[model samples]
Target: MTTDPLHILKTVYGYDAFRGRQAEIVDHVIAGNNAFVLMPTGGGKSLCYQIPALCRPGMGLVVSPLIALMADQVAALRQAGVRAAALNSDLPPEERRDLWRAIGEGTLDLLYAAPETLLRSGIIDRLRNIPLSLIAIDEAHCLSQWGHDFRPHYRQLDALVDLFPDTPRMALTATADAPTRGEIVAHLQIGNDDSFIAGFDRPNIRYAVEEKDNPRRQLMRFLQNHENESGIVYCLSKRKTEETAAWLQDQGYNALAYHGGMDKAAREVNQTRFQREEAVVMVATIAFGMGIDKPDVRFVAHIDLPGSIEAYYQETGRAGRDGLPSEALMLYGADDIALRRRFIDESDAPDTRKRMEQQKLDALLGLTETAQCRRQVLLNYFGDACSPCGNCDTCANPPERFDGTVAAQKVLSCIYRTGERFGQAYVIAVLLGDEDERIARFGHDRISTFGIGKEHDQRTWRSILRQLIAHGFIHVDLAGHGGLSIAEAGRRFLREKPVLMLRTPPPAAKGRKGRAARGGVPVSLDQTDSALFNALRDKRIEIAREQNLPPYVIFHDKTLIEMARTRPANRADMAGISGIGEAKLDRYGEAFLAVIAGHQPDAG
Candidate 1:
């Protein structure tokens, strides 16, 4: 029952020091002040509130967005020997009564509930009578309409400020741009000096984008490097998710499909398997990954382009949450770009919102098409900057550039000559002098720009057109079924003839040869250590199965990797490992020490 933060951190969470701005934010809340925290995923955000709650006198009330996330956090806290419980619809009546009894007796340290549950009349009335340590709003960005994932229920949480006038309030989120940040601060009434923005950077993640040429083969190549690892494959449609999962399953992968179209019970089952098993790959649409707390996802692949950079960042941030190496590969094409634009143009949002969405989409396209460092562009979007990170694909293999003034001019003139009423396929066909009946009927066969771009192949022309759209030299006509039209920039390019450099079309896929072809964040263990790591994982899985909990809830892969390398022989040595708190050391130290003692290294 100590109130010292550092003492609590070392003995309770087993961390030697706080990461980044966690200590400052934690101290601010502990001093009975409201603060807004913007830290990246896996940046130890939970500690900013959890530590303060432990140091204060009363129970901490956490507002989370998902039931699964709440349950996982409660389980992890319980493992650390903290009194934590979650209130949700899934809890049985008897269990709910028990939790309420503990609350009445001042035995619970932290309580997690969804925003909807907290706003209920009975729940609010009961909570008002108790002493509150802090009111924490996780995923606070959901309160803003400008955020990628907006929930109407979150907007109602502003009442907490009035209901608990004297208690400290903290709002935390991992993904929020300037506008979204502003909206959150205004709605929550956070003080200007109290806002702390730990920069939005996950340096362990390697970013790579490839043109969609035989997407299945490209995805397969990416998957080869991540064998038997947990990951997510994002698609744009429910049917595509199911198809991709089935295809991966056919190819001997443990893949599952998830989307809004699936039955609720079926979705729950699939999600459970994904959480409990180590190697499950969830092929899902945007519906699958808002509040997933899985810590060891090694990769995230996108078969289609996401709507904006915010969505992409939030989705990819789900990987490598345990701070190990991870990869994010996105397969994009001109068609994906067109489809995304059409979705924006066809939506019923107001003009201002649509324009903002378009701008966001444009920023994402810039990131995808940039010949410079990918990390630079991504960080710059969130008003942060970094030097050329050597981890991204562009830094590993810099794209070759060529003067593309003529190519730009030819594409622009073709769109105009064809009356600006054709999509990329037809425009590229006219450029390459194809013998299609549509081109013949349009009499574009005799156009002056016809066959001018035949020097480049179809893939090359597709690349060129996609860059044009991304750069704002051209615009998509949603009314004309994604026809191309010249923007003012394109008109200026034609009139003024500026020098333009375009990236060379990447070479044809050679298919990854083996593990030797892997790049970006080397694997943590060598051959001998890998065998021991596997053995430790097997032991963890066995224990987790017996306890009916996810293996990560038992111990993260990072902890197991540490054990494998250090070969902790006894309880004292095991307790010195990073994640092994006093409680876990008492609960699991002997078992893990036995694992290390029993392992037999390969002789070869």
Candidate 2:
């Protein structure tokens, strides 16, 4: 029953060294031990379970929750010369039966099934007779009630874990706060002997948060800086997802929208394109991000706030996945806080659950408005000490702030003079002395405060107003009441006694020609083989068109780009490209050799 333990790591896995704690975790798992790993997206979590699967005797039962999770991970494993298979409701009965037969015959080394599969009547009954080696749970936070994402079916996994207690368990998650970590152990009843970890710091990713103005324009500028790099934008609602995607596409990026509303086939197509193509920006709701395996995404930008800090970390963790320097930008406003509170308060959960939900919302708000460095804010949430990452926009392009107590006093005075009963646009109009029709109708142009703020442009004044609201010096009237009201903090400003500082409105976020890399990265492209890569790509496309499948199905554009950049000259070298499947190298791979042999110019 014993096997050489480290062979898989060096041979089939193709990695010479373990990333972070992979070697230690693999040692534990191969010794019939348990582990709880909290690695980030590209921290090599898969290999910890995968190498052990090959080293153990029976099939490794990986209980994943999503259909796409099973399919993507299984595809990647099978491509890596591992015998892996997945069973899910998405497949027809015939294919399901075929997978079962393979499992029964011991032909499968690893198997992926949804948690709901264990609930099927005869399936669990039959599964009891099969020999099980270990159970690995991905995205283990779903089991926690306090977790932002709670799945009822995942909560039921405890019963299943109790039934198979003898099999060693390892729970792996990309992101989990302390509360969720405790829940994972308690829900699974993991033994005290199991390992628990936080993980390594990817110091390459620069984190930044900008107070909201025109968020769309700001995002456009961020994209322009990382021109021709992969990124993602997460929106809270489906409508915003579609609009942002359409807007980016209009600006000439290959952007795609995905949400739960879309048909399954469309989501799959968009996801496949993002994985295989270059410079694609995917705009999606939260539903689209789980289990996507693409590794080189350069940034994750958020237009709206996520429900919790854990969700934000995991979502942004999708970027900088190849150990390259990347960006995580968030544009937040006070409206986002109100929206989150509305969502949580309106949910049908019990009173206790709603109270917990409020704490989560408060945490997100604190993150948005943190006075400290962005990395310091993030690491503190996870119980770690971190220094200021001197590379973010906050550090690189430091804001110039001036004392604004006088200006705040004037704005509040105008609100009072106008009867304190107008929304932002109207208030701004009266202060700026704009004799627009609304101003005349309200007779606000005749007020004493009118024409006083005319020294500043309308946009600049609005940014100041927004910052005031965010700082809690002023508050928006709720319940369809449209005017601004002075909060308790605003009283200090109105009393002409407090010193408040305000940043200048940031630059318009568009039309940057090129953004030189801020820090920590030297080059964008691998220098060794850029030319030969193009020739191989042409051959791939010609063959793909002849075969009638998508070009990526033959070989991803990423693989071709890497091939040219790395200039691999032999079969073994070609196999190292990330997207090259085994069946692909067996076919159409030799054609790439002629190009690599000489730096052939791409065919005209």
Candidate 3:
């Protein structure tokens, strides 16, 4: 067995080198020191602990939060020929017995358990006898009360330090701002000096935020380019998830709905099908995406605004896990913004927590309404400096901004004139001179602000309103039936009449040209190589189905692309590919070699 992390990485996991801080973190762990890692998804955070576990003396204990995540990690590790097992409530009795036997015999290289399961007296007793090389708390942000995915059980994990006094511990998460990061460190008892913060920028993901107008049609248009690709469409409500899933199914697309409201068996089935099949779209609420391990999800679309920047980053991080080009689009309306504000105000959290959450929401809203590069704004939130990425929507079709002091004044005047008691729809109706009975009864049709905004359409005015709310010039009054109310900034803006520059949304694309306008994935392979890649993909899928495993567990698309480009001919040639580990070469080299040599069994 190789003791060198680099050698173990190549011979087992089959990667050439560590990415970013992976090598540093691995060395820290191998030296029997603790670590704290914050790396973006697809940044290979797992290798930091996995490599060290293989090089160290005993099995690595991974504290997983979800059963599905645990199973997925164990499967992937086993496929790489590492001795791994996940002990969870989902395991059959016989399987649990076998896992315990393996643990007692010191036969496993890694063991994954949820926080609740690991804290049990029985499991704790067993772990005390078994030597642990290192303990890795995956998704450590869950321990933070300030984090979006806070798990109560995770708070008890501080006891791990006391129980395993001699073992080095690592805490890791993908989405944590400074406050949340500090909370994670404190809760996990990890040293602050050992923290490794990788850049939060997922450069491969093209960020696009479109003002909502005809949202269903706009979503369909965006999905056109992603046909035959796996993606996720996030909705704010469970009802929306079901409706979107059904509507997409009616449109001849394979779609599934997932949410916490669904039956456990049903949700599990949908998630399983999504993982096992290709090109499946999952329309889901916020309940679906924590600790997901799917690597080939090509896109993630948001039909509504997410609550906070942290939640948005963590959710969008689900796409393009294989380092391939992927896209994320957020379609939000003024209504969505108001609704999110209402939800925040109505939450049972403490005043300080709510204030922090409100700040986070403001940051995300600022990103959506800004004319600057979306990537820069997102990275800046994580304290990472970024240049304008030419791949995002704002970069491809930069929106124009104009002096909107008059528009801002007009919006403020309308709210003031309407008694600040009406919601955005009624307010917009009054602005657009709609002859609604309510507007007439409230005498809003006679107000000086009525019809003054007819120069731009209703959509334009709504965009302006959202920008105002985002900038803190206005706020939603949840107690007043989701009505719009002027904030201190709005009063100051009206009195000061500052020059307000608001973004002018780009005109909607009329045809299939939208994809080209959005800047697509760079093709790395020529036509001939591409065809070979598809053939290799088919073979991998067939093998995956036979083994009852996700295709990526066999080999990621990145690995297959390399194989197609090189066109390896024999065992030696196959072994040279980036993802072909020694174990995989012995098990699959001959089959993949045959496929590359034009002897594919299924290429009739």
Candidate 4:
């Protein structure tokens, strides 16, 4: 009757109002009902379990895949004054036993563990003895054979649901197509549990796709669009990860590479460095995205196409977690698909696995080929209805598609006139009326349509080629190596009629630095007391150093920056910054106030 949930939310978690159905989901879990939560990246999935853990009489057992993810979540929870600990391989036996004792003694409210360990002998019974109230599965889709990221350990987790049938359980994921969702429920053996689908509209995440050409340079250019913001760039290979990280460092960006190929200790070091350090961009492969709990990542870029749309959605969801505007840019080519296909085809996976892999590949192909609003296509796969995001590249810049009957003739004529023996660059040069050495050597200057489309610039011609390939209007002969061949769509465009809507490239990003200019925390009030903010941050670091704790343990970068801007003169005014909870305010409040008072009087 008193809305105890609202009181708990504001006082315990510091959120004045619930985001979306977070309060409802917590209410459901607290009511002792099993729930399946399908929320987007920033959708507050943790609260479903965390809040329930606090409300329920006993501890909650959270099954998670990544140790770093579990550790980060535990760190954040403990920071907010919750009692949490993690059991993982990284913990020494002494520490693991101590943690187990804490859980048994009821000193811990939540405990996180990997499935591999949970499935180990005697762990389930040990958990039963601790009076667990709920069992939550994070990244629950990994149980799906239909998913890109399936784990045998997750298959073993189904045993837990049967063991704790009476106990309410929650399974959560960010990206699960319908098939994967069904697999998660069935695999978890919670077929009758309620499922909640938070809207998949990552409205704050602007999605864009760029055709691959000098992908590393394109990545650099793209990062420049959102400069100085923290982001993640996913690559297909470890070599590229290292190289890209190095190149970004050369350009004066704080970048680091992470991959499975590295030593375990080294990977852990880099991951810690990234998590604890602010504005450190981690260039890693798919492995890096899975267990990360960093909430402030402003962008996610794929230097290569993810293996499936499911994978793509999950990777991109990692951005915009703070619910502010963010960007997800994918630079892809057919070769990326082929490489993953080759890996799958050549692997020793069983025939069933191969078939599943093929189906996943087909879904990705459908996504790439469809000219429909990408948001519509992406959401449709999840059985959700959404209008075109109107902000995506496809919707905003409606490509100037012609009934390629004319330009196709120009393209095909240039190809035909030059005997069709060239790659895209030479062909584009011919179309652009470039009288270069290559054109003369190939005698393309003598072609009929050589200068016909001089009205269009080279970039426009390139975009046309990209759309042609994307729209099935042209084919790049992978076997002919790099030669362009007219496909049936191209033939139709040339002889019959094919409408092509050309998409205009977005304008250049302009901002303070070379980083991405698109996405970040809102510049609502110009939080740029840069000198004062820097000074406050220095004080926070000095205090953290003196206390021998991580800087975040004192106050996160965001909290310190907020104090610098608000310049709150008193304790009451200091309480409004995000992440500055009562405990943090009481512990470090006076110091922050002293710094702010030293700078100036109350501005807010």
TM-score of each: 0.96, 0.84, 0.95, 0.83
lDDT tens digits, residue span 176-279, model 4:
88888888887776655488888677888877776676787778777776655688999989999999899999998899899989998899888877766666
Winner on TM-score (3 vs 4) = 3
lDDT per residue (tens digit) for residues 1-604 in model 1:
8999988998888877888998899889999999899999999999999999999989999999999899889998999999999999889999999999999999999999999999999999999998999999999989999988899999999999899999999999999999999988888888889899999999999899998989999999999898778999999999999999999999999999999999999998999899999888999999897658889988999999998898999999999999988999998987788778788888999999899998999999988988999999999999999999999989988999989899999999999999988888999999999899999988899989889998899889988988988788988876668888999989999999989999998888797643542222236577677777887888999998998888888888888888888898788788788888898988888888877777746434
Local lDDT at 97 for model 4: 87
RMSD in Å for all candidates: 2.2, 4.4, 2.6, 4.5
Q: Evaluated with lDDT, which candidate comes out highest? A: 1
* Model 2 CA lDDT for position 357: 77
Give the worst 10-residue stretch by lDDT in candidate 2: 518-527
By TM-score, the candidates rank as: 1, 3, 2, 4
Q: lDDT of each prediction vs. the true structure?
A: 0.90, 0.74, 0.87, 0.75
Candidate 2: tens digits of C-alpha lDDT, residues 423-524 = 778788887888699788878778789889877788778777876775667667654454677777787667766687777766765464445642212135
Residue 212 lDDT in model 1?
Answer: 90
Clashes of each: 0, 2, 0, 16
